[model samples]
Target chain A: MNGVFAKLRTGLAAAALASTALAGPVSAQQVKEFWHYLGAGGELEGVEGMMEVAKSKIDEEFTHRVVPGGSAGLRQQVQVSLMGGVPPMAYQVSAGLELNQLAQSGRLVPLTEAWEQINGDEIFPEGLIQVISYGDEKYGLPFAMSMLGNTWYNKGIFEELGLEVPTTWEEWDEVATTLEENGYVALTSGGGSAAWTIYQFYAALFDAAGADGYWEFVGGMMPLDDPRFVEAVDLFEAHFVKYFDDEWTGGVWSDGLDRLMAGEVAMYNMGDWASGYMRQRGWTPNEEYSFFPAPSLQNVTIFQSDVIVVLKGEETDLGMKFAAAAASPEAQQAFNAAKGSIAPSNEIDPSFYDPIAKMEYDKLVSEDAIVLPNLYVLMPSGFKEDLGNAFTRFGATKDRAAFDEELARLEEMRKEMYEAGEFGTF
Target chain B: MTTLNPLAAIPFRQRDRMTYFIFLMVPAVLYVAAYIYPTIETFRLSFFEWDGFSPPEYIGLENYWELLGEPRFRNAFFNNLKWLVFYLTLPTVTGLALALLLDAELRGSVVFRTIFFIPFTITTVAVASAWRWMYKPSNGVMTQFVEALGFDAPNWLGDPSINTYSIMGAALWAWSGFTFLIYFGGLRALPTELIEAARIDGAKFWTILFKIKLPLLWPSTIVVLGIAAVDSMKIFDLVWAMTQGGPYRSSSVLAVEMYETSFVMFKLGQGAAVAFVLLVVASIVVMPYIYHMTRQVDEVKE
Candidate 1:
């Protein structure tokens, strides 16, 4: 009876081995979670679709999910979540202190090995690649990029009012005046929406200061009291107070975007994300809406990118695949197409983008193009906030002295931040 | 009853001690873990300059000193004080009025009560969104109404001069329900004979409200004031969701400031300092009331 039992066990074991051989390699029990904030049909949605594109490489071993919140609210959630030990395997962060500080401090898992494995160097431009790395290590992979100075306009309104896309500040002002005189929204710049819109000061300053000071101003090496700074602020203050409706402070950036597309507003300068927003609202680019770099910003792209950060403990094999997949040209094209933003990968097919994105992309690679980093992204945490508050105060200023005072106030804060070495490696 | 209380036959000390500890153990452990530990940790954190992730450096009183010197801190502190004063008085008065209006127990009073309580039931995020629209200068209902009435509505959420009051109005709308419910409960618990006697003595509505009812509602008033004051000290979500402590940080309160410092700015030490200051301020406002209440409880027991 013992011999018979042993034979039976042997037979069963052999059968199990045969079944395993036929079934193929079993994937690990892992799911990579992505964190971003927004609704079902925007950036987050576009990313969710990219997970499908990634499946051929990673799906056998990994699944991806997204947790969402408001933009700033989501950033806070990622920080607190990391502190709680378990964090999103990958999360979207702006390309600056939030990413750099974490990446530099080694709290974030560097993605260099993954980038190398994926041949990211060949896919992304050297300059673009350099922007996403910090302290000689890459910590984030770019998913979506937007230039902040893309002033979107409703084509129908432009046609109705006989307005051409303004190529300079003077022309922009005249257009604003024309739109307002015709009883339409002129420009959307102020409070109540995303405060980062206030960073258009950098854009306005670019036009006001010429390219050299613009570079210096944004490099965090220039004084806020620069004549260019005052000129930009004065231009900003006057334009904001006069052209913007009293409601801009109550409505956020998206509000202006919506109003612009609906033909209620002629123009509003927003990040490249506006293309995604416009598309999400079912508007066709060029036909329904058209955009250009902000007036006076010659061949400039003040870009902000949403980069995927892999947390330290979350550097599992599957996690790396997810990060690599995020930066894949295929993923970038799909995401940019859906998100109405340009793909960060230079190798991506231009045909994958909409007309507006293609136009922006054209400028991005132009010989004259100067792709300045988004000012808000470069500033330390809450520094952009300080600038926004000062801008608001400046909006309420009646005279040059008060305007100069706000500038001095911002300069003092920047000086203190500089002393504290917040600029790090500017 | 004569069945000999066998359970009670045990010595009072033993029964009381075992039961007390067994019941209190879970709560005591939880309290220590959740509240006391964090409070102590925050106090300790206040001394060190640390971003949430990085190694903390001992900065001693530097964070506190900066808090004292910072203008934003002063603004937030003053704003909190404004919230405290406005909240303690306005909500209580309006709630009392609402309670009185609904206290008549007339037809549809229950409906009226439910309607008033609805704002309190909605989440703060939703409440802020709703009120933000109403306070919107361009197309908000309030703005349109004012314009219709032949006056320009000041930017309710924009102007620093009136933004705080505009927010206070929303807080009042959302919070008055809880106050009303508490006051109503207190009125329910009052001696009906006193009100009836006043009525018989020709006490009108105003007289009954001022003389008979309000005097009897002292304890409820104290509770409302305590809750309102403490709650106002921690008003963050509404202020953050609505204005983000902005239009220029004019409407910033201590709670919003603390959150921005700690999370947004990642200045853990400074944020902790703000939290400590807020705790100290809240305790200062609530302590005397607590002492008085404790004395009152002792008197009742006596």
Candidate 2:
């Protein structure tokens, strides 16, 4: 009688196991793990809200891990894990060569099918797709877009000085001179990270010269000795020397921001994302601070977006599904609204955006600004190192002649990279 | 009597010998496997070019050749040499002198000894961070103090020429305590009778220190010098936490350069190569001291 009862129990267990197997693919009801580098207080809260909403919509248990890192740290961790045959289900990556590197390493799953299934090809902006896609393969889904051409300022200081937002390079100089005359540091800049603050100068210059002309000269389509490139370098160096604070050489990006917030400096050129920091410090847009498109240098603004890539691993199918869900219009609206950025998916209502972000987005869309790939992403790693060295030299010397010499050397390096086909074929 | 049962007697001695060998060799074997094997692997890895992710490609001596030619690497190597010379000598000398002073029958000697050794109690990261803030150009305490004294405060970290020296000043503060402790113990262990005899022979204090104390403190000197040399060669934490080998890589040491090349640049092979070169240089500097010490130990035992 005991043997017969044991056999009955085993039969019931097997039937239950078979039933689960027949259910066909782990449903959205299963637990999913997500990794991100959003460790900042506001950003972390925003991500948690999005995750909560995602879990509510899907039948799955959501587990989100906040990876403590910046871009380099995240990349190193992800790359090491991926190469070692273990990778996170999903993680955020910058759109471009970072995505390309993952794809080449066979650590990224193609998301073309996922995009089609979700109708992302229609909802997402073509420009954003172009940025995140490699060849015929899609490795990431864009969630938020950042505007890189905004110059934030202390509104109180500007109003007291009766300085209007400058629209051209000459006017910018006048404003800087006026501010300096009034005992305010004209501009706050930091060279600690080399490329972070310098990108503003590079983008402004690229815009002024016309996209084609800038690329032909600075991008090594033409010789480094081109007079136009030298002129641009001189202009960039002159502005850097004339306007930036004396202590800028040792200051980090956050320090410059702190100086601006403390009213020690009148203005700083940075990305739209910098507003998040200001908001966190209890400064509201159009009240304590205001931002405008950077003046002069051809009025061109370069844009970029942050993307989420599904790392290929044991749970790749689940990872791809999670990334797709994260990229959906509903998810984009929830995430970008809380995080203070524009959604890459055009389906989201503009009314959901904050006043500052809406204004930046409208301007960017209407002007059809050029999206210049970050130099670090566009150039080979070695070339990026050389470029950083050159920038360091330029910052230290504050010499137009030296800047031009460095630009010439950079041109040579870019040419070598182009010939080697290091930057992927356009 | 042994011939009656030589085999039986041999087994007993063999058992004792086996136990002795285990006692002596186990700890050393574990230590070498844990430490020395990894170090040798790091050297071997120097010959390959890898990004730590991709499969490592054998690049022969290309990395070494490039390192020899690269201006940044050369600057770091030369700076390391400067650190070894200045950092090793200045702190050791000052520490020995302080130790000698304390060894004398001075009032509150214990308090003075504790006070002098306080800097070593602070962690390297904390010391470096404090010093970095102090050396800040505009608002730093050092800058403020200098300006109060009616002098301009040069950019201690920003200026490439002075950055390494500034970092060294911070290092010296943390290191002097350690050397002082070693020397203090050495001075305390000296035979009192010999010193008393030298004083009775009309030897002056300075003459006694040079003629008697220093010679007897040879063992301590060798140990201190060896430790200081090795520590200076492998210096990383303070430099990393303070300047990050920056102000245009002026403060870069071999360790920092190796890290940047391997992790930041994703060039692991080159990083390993730099590390190996650093090891070779360190061995060249330290092996002779180690050999001499070993020989001295043998002589003392004999």
Per-candidate TM equals 0.88, 0.86
Clashes by residue pair, model 1 = A193-A252
Model 2 agreement with the true structure over B171-240: per-residue lDDT tens digits: 8888888889999999999999999999999999999999999999988888889988898789888877
True contacts kept of each: 0.42, 0.21
**lDDT measured at residue B104 in model 1 versus the true structure, 0 to 100:** 83
Error of 1 at B211 (Å): 2.6
Every candidate's lDDT: 0.76, 0.73
Alpha-carbon deviation at A236 in model 1, angstroms: 3.9
Q: Give the per-residue lDDT digits (tens) of candidate 1, residues B42-95.
A: 887799887765556789999999899778999999999999899899999999
Q: How well does candidate 1 reproduce the true complex, by DockQ?
A: 0.22
Docking class of 2: incorrect
